[model samples]
Structures are given as structure tokens and as C-alpha cells.
Target: MSHTSTAQKKLLSRVRRIKGQASALETSLEGEPKCISVLQQIAAIKGAVNGLMREVLEDHLRAHLGAPDISQTQRDEEIENVILILKSYLK
Candidate 1:
């Protein structure tokens, strides 16, 4: 099974919540809510996305680099690849 399979329910719940947050933001815009309230919703969405990303990254690290069956050289290569991916992603 894929790494995400283990967390599928939780991830889906998070996504649903993010969607709700987006919907609320849209409704707030229609209702002319305070600027701070809108900003807070935006920040909440950002935090949700970041939390999902962090969970996936941690799962990848544990599945690949932390596997007991993986050789040292393979682990080192995986680490480099992960670092490159992170660098590109961050940019």
C-alpha cells in the first residue's frame, strides 16, 4: 500500500476541513467581514496545507531512509534525492 493509504482517512478529513475553510472565507467576503477575520481564515488554510506537507515528508523519511532493510549507500542516496526534492520544492 502507498504511504498515504495509512493516513487516507485523516488526510481526507483535513482536506474537507480546508475546503470548509475556503468556503467560509468566500462567504465572509460576500458578507463583508472584517479584514482581520478574512486574513485569519487565509492563515488557517495555509497552516492546513503546511501540516499535510509535513506529514507526507515525515512518512517518506520513515518509509525510505528509516527502513531497516535498506543499505547504507541506498539510504545516503535516498537522503540526497530527498534533499534535492526539498530544495527544489522550497524554491
Candidate 2:
């Protein structure tokens, strides 16, 4: 999609950072890192992934379901359905 094309650089950056975090986590496992330190790295990775998800989701909403030409009622329903899917996905 055009929106994704526009966001390609930003999305790839986030993915690269997430990959670095995963590498750090693996390195930590190979050493004697404290449990809390390892957990913190894991948490950071999770947060980064969630941030990426949020950005992609927002772009999808804006470019597709939130298009200005759609009827209001249909747009509202589509948005609600997207929200429902997101909620389930996060659980």
C-alpha cells in the first residue's frame, strides 16, 4: 500500500532496533547477566514491538477504513471491527 511505502523507512528502523534488542538478549543469556537485567531487556523488546504495531495499525486505519470518502456509518463500523480485532490480538 502507498501508506506502507511511505512508512517503509521508519518501520524498517524499528525492526532493526528490535533485532538488536533480540541479539542483546541472546548475548545476555550467554553470559552471567543478572535476572532483572535480562528481564528488562525482554521488556524493552516487547515495548518496541508494541510501538511498531501501533504505528502500522494507525497507518492502516487512516489509509483504509478512515478514508474520507467512505460513508460515516460504514467507516464507524469498520473502525469498531478493527478495534475489536486489535483488542483480541493484544490479549
Candidate 3:
């Protein structure tokens, strides 16, 4: 099975948790929440998103770039793609 298929359940769980965090953040924003509380929620959401991104990036690197069966050209292409994405993500 593909790496994505193997991790689908875990990834989905993380996504669901992030969704819940977003919903809670929205609700908190709608009420008289303290500034610190709102900031903490925002931080939590950011951390969760970063964690998910890291997981997917690592998987992509391993599955697409590190696979021995693929050609060097293919690996170079994957590296370029990763670089482009990282540049955009960092921005």
C-alpha cells in the first residue's frame, strides 16, 4: 500500500482535530473571550496545521524522493516541487 493509504486514518484524525480547534476558535471569537485565550487558541491552530504539514512533507519526501526504483530525474523533479512548495509555505 502507498504511504498515504497507510496513514489515511491518522491523517484524517488530525484533520478532524484541527477542524474542531477551528470551530472552537470561531466560537470564542464570537463571544467575550479574553485576549490571551484567543491568542492561545490561534497558537494551537497554527501548531496543529504545522504538524500536519510536516507529516505530509516527510511522507512525500520518503515516498516520492527516496524510492530507489525512481530515476534521478524524477527525484530532482520532486525536490524542485518540494522547494517551490516550501518557499510558498514559508511566505
Q: Enumerate residue pairs that collide in model 2.
A: none
TM-score of each predicted structure versus truth: 0.76, 0.80, 0.95
Clashing pairs in 3: none
**Candidate lDDT (C-alpha), each:** 0.89, 0.92, 0.95
The regions of model 1 sitting more than 4 angstroms off are 71-77, 88-91
Across 1-91, the per-residue lDDT of candidate 2 in tens digits comes to 7999998999999999999999999999999999999999999999999999899889988888868898989888888988897889789
Candidate 2 lands at a TM-score of: 0.80
Comparing 2 with 3 on TM-score, the higher-scoring candidate is: 3
lDDT by residue (tens digit), candidate 3, 68-88: 999989899989999999999
Residue 81 of model 2: what lDDT? Answer: 81
Candidate that beats the other on lDDT, 1 or 3, i.e. the better one: 3
- The positional error of residue 35 in candidate 1, measured at the CA in angstroms, is 0.9
lDDT of candidate model 2 versus the reference:
0.92
Off by over 4 Å in 3: none
